[model samples]
Target: MNVLVIGASRGIGLELVRQYLDAGQRVIATARDADGLARLKDVGAQTIQLDVADPASVSGLSWLLDGEKLDLALYVAGVFSTGGAISPPTQQDFDVMMHTNVLGVMQALPQVAPWVEEAGGQFAFLSSDMGHIGDSRSSRGWLYKVSKAALNMAVVAAQPDYPRAQFLLLHPGWVQTDMGTSAAALTVQDSVSALRQTLAKHKSSKTIHGCDDVPYLQWDGRPFAGW
Candidate 1:
């Protein structure tokens, strides 16, 4: 399969690239710092340079992949910032998060979405339980939760418009990575394993579930409010 992974330089993204490459799939991995992703190149993954926050960069990638057929496009690029009841997000932090998590979706549609549409491939936005209003556990990381929540809704809204393609919003759980931290419940490998298993079960049906998390303490972003 022709697989494209954005943000493949570190953590879960890096692991995803490794797994796909080991599966003998043609994998194209992207990172803002191409040098950082050199390990992917060493592992036989074709590395592409990408900055999800930049429209120009997204457009450049779109042009590069326009002629190619892509079977899977996974948006794994994300950012996190600390926020608490007393300390809300700065305008810059909010903009950066939304730019990558939300605007990146908008940017990617013109590029990879068409390939998925034509090939009937699968598309997924890495989502978080922080967006789940159904859960009552609150989180203090406003930037991460809100961006993920917006991404989930974006996936829900866009799934239908693409023909033959299945759009999924997945919660990878609290993984032990720079973002998830050592206190997180799952290792990056374990989390990716579960996430891959969940993704492998996709059908044309319209529904969503990837072990939901309780609503936690989020800052002012209202990451838990899904409506």
Candidate 2:
């Protein structure tokens, strides 16, 4: 299958590229920098330069992949801010997180959605459980939480526009990555293994449910009740 992995510079994104290639899939990996692109190329992935926050870059990506059809278009780009209090976040923090986590998806969805739809494939975003409004009980990573929440809604909002493609919001289960930290609950391998299995199951099923029914899912492909 042909797959596209956005924000594949490091961490979970990079690992996904590696594992997909190992599975003998044709993988296209995108990153914002030359170094990241080079690293992805070393792993046998076709690399593209894309900055989700930049409209020009996003538009260019559409032109670049115009004729190519993707079986899976996975967006793994996101940012996390440290401070988490009742107080509002600083303008810079808010902008960075929103731009990377929210607007980034907004900008890329339009371009990638058609590709996935044309191929009768799936579009998955790497979302977090922290974004679950019904599950919130503490105040931590407030900025990141807000951004991811917005991302979840954005995915739902876009679903109707691309009925042929299945849109999914996935939580990677706090894997050991830069964002998840060394003390995270699961390793990158564990998370990616489950993720691949989930993707395979979804592909085999060929059924797309309503947004409310399957909005958010765990890494293992089970529906997340809290969402």
Candidate 3:
């Protein structure tokens, strides 16, 4: 199987690359910096230097991936903002969060979705349950929530254009990553393992959970209600 992990410098993305390589699948992973590229290379993944937040950088992705039919393509690049509605986000914070969480996904969709479609694969974007408006509880990271909400809409809207590929908006749960913090519930390994399993299930299913389209799902393969 051929897998492409975008933004694989560290955290969940890096772990995904490691796990897939361990499973003996051919992996191509991307990182924004030299250090990140080195780490991915050390893990035995074919590496690409990429910064999803930059339009010019993302524009060349298709060229790099030419002639490859990806079995799984994951858009895991994201940034978090801690400001609530009352605290109002700064311009820099807003740009960083929105660009990484929403705009970056939009930019890469056109480039990578077709590759996944070619192999009847799964295209997943890492989203958060905090983005679910109906399930909203706290406004701890209101800016991030808004950005992810937009991310959900972007991926779900693009699904119709790539009907052969199963597009999934996934919440990896509260993971123990840089963004999720050490106090989070699930470890990175557990979260990513479950996410891989969920992607496998979606890829093999004709209709997920009896639904014709599965727009949003948890890492454990459960669908999100009112998302």
Candidate 4:
């Protein structure tokens, strides 16, 4: 299988690339840093340097992979702001997060969606538990939270547009990623394993139930035992 992983330079994105490649998949890992892409190249995965915040880059991604076939496309590129959601919110940080987390996904969809649809593949995106507004317990990282929440809805909205493809709005949990900090519950390996399980159990099937639970997460999606 061929996979395209965005934001493969660091954190959970990086680990996902590693795990996929180890599973003998042909991986094309893209990041904003040239050096980061180069490192993944040494690991038997092809690399592309892309800035999802740039429309030109998103358009160019299609051309880079035109000659190849893709089986999985995972979008995990995001930016984090220091402002704890409410106080001292910086305009620059908000713009950055919105571009990377929100608009970027919107722009990327038009390009990657057709390719996956033509190939009969899977589409997975990284959402967060924080994105769950219905289950909001508190608020600190407001910008990040809102952007990811928007992204989740974006994926949900796109499902109908690409009926043959499985669109995953996955929550990797509080993983110990660079953005996640060391105090997180699960390691990249553990969180990704759950994500993988969820992906497999829900892959390429359409019942409006392409959701996950870590086989153990509490209060995942809405409703119970029905699609």
Candidate 5:
């Protein structure tokens, strides 16, 4: 299968690339810097230099993957910030977080979704339960929460346009990554394993629910309701 992993430098993204490669799938991965590219290369993935937060960089994506039909596409790039309503985020923090977490995905959607659609594939975005509006209790890292919520909306909004691709918003749980920190609940391995399992079980049977049925799921396949 052909898979595309966007923002595959480290953490969940990197682990995804590693697992897929070990499974003997053809994988194309993107990283923003030399170190990241080197790491992906070391793990045997086709590497592309892409900074999703930059429009100019994202604009070249379709060209990069031309003629390729992707069986799966994972948008796993994001930024995290710590702040609450009381500790208002600075303009810089807001811009960086929103640009990376929300705007980057928006820019990448049009570029990557077509390839996934061509293959009747799955397009999954890495989101967080912290983004769940109805389920949210704490305001800590509220800005980050707002960014992920916007990301969820972006994926849902784009789903209808890519009818053959299953658009999924996945919460990888409290993963033990740099973003999640060491104290988080799940290790990167366990989180990504369940996520891969979830993807394997999903197929582009749009007829079952049509394009409007974008699924918001956890790493474990449990559906998350109430946006």
Candidate 6:
């Protein structure tokens, strides 16, 4: 299978590229810069320079793909920031998070979705459980949560436009990564492994759970309630 992993320079994106390549799949990974890309290339992935926040860069991916059909395309680009009630998020923080997490997905989907649809493949956005309004309790990471909530909406709105492809919003659990930190509940390997298994199970399935009217889903392939 042919796979496309966006924001693959590090963390979950990087792991996804590695695992896909290990499975003998043709993987194309992208990052904003060349940092960490050499490692991905070393692992048998074709690396591309892409910045989802930049429209020109996203549009360039279309030409780079050369109309090659993609079996799976995953958008894993996002940003997070933590601030308590005493110290709220700054304007810069909001802008960076929203641009990368929300607008970036909105812009890239149009360019990448068609490629997946052409091959009857799957397209997914890496969202977070914090985005689930029904599961909300704490006020921490408000900015990050709001950005992902917007991303969920974007995914749902775009689904109807691409009837042939499966659109999923996956929550990769609380992974122990740079963003998730050491205190996170799950390790990156376990999280990615479970997500890969879920992807494998749904590879040929026409229905996308939780995507009929909403786009909230867990990494274990279960739908989020009250979404």
Quantify all predictions' global Cα lDDT against the true fold: 0.73, 0.88, 0.89, 0.75, 0.90, 0.85
Per-residue lDDT tens digits of candidate 1, residues 89-125? 7888889989998898778865787787666677777
Per-residue accuracy of model 6 over 51-164 as CA lDDT, tens digit each: 888777887777788777988999999999876456778898888889899989988888888899889999988998999998988878889889988999899888878877
Taking all chains together, each candidate's TM-score versus the true structure is: 0.85, 0.95, 0.95, 0.87, 0.97, 0.93
Which ranges of candidate 3 are over 4 A from the true structure? Answer: 204-212
In model 6, which range of ten residues has the least summed lDDT? Answer: 207-216
**Would you give me the overall lDDT of model 2?**
0.88
**Candidate 2 lDDT score at position 107:** 91
* Top TM-score prediction, candidate number: 5
RMSD of each: 5.6, 1.5, 2.1, 3.8, 1.4, 1.9
Worst 10 contiguous positions by lDDT, candidate 1: 212-221
Model 2, span 111-223: residue lDDT tens: 89889988898899999999989898777988888888899989988887787888889999988998889999999999999998997786632445456744488899888
Instruction: Flag clash pairs in model 3.
Output: none
Error of model 5, residue 113, in angstroms: 0.5
User: Looking at model 4, how many pairs of residues clash?
Assistant: 3
What residue pairs are clashing in model 2?
none
Worst 10 residues of 5 by lDDT: 203-212
Which runs of model 4 end up more than 4 angstroms from their true locations?
82-88, 207-227
Cα lDDT tens digits for candidate 3, 1-227:
99999999999999999999999999999999999999999999999998989999999999999989998999999988787877767899988988888889999999998899889888889998999999999889899899999998888777877877888889999999999999999999999999989888767524233223755889998988887
lDDT head-to-head 5 vs 6, winner: 5
Best by lDDT: 5
Better of 3 and 4 by lDDT: 3
For residues 132-206, what per-residue lDDT tens digits would candidate 5 score against the true structure?
Answer: 898999899899999999998888877877778888889999999998999999999999999999988866567
Candidate 3: 10-residue stretch with minimal lDDT: 203-212
C-alpha lDDT (0 to 100) for residue 50 of candidate 3: 89
lDDT of 6 at 77: 93
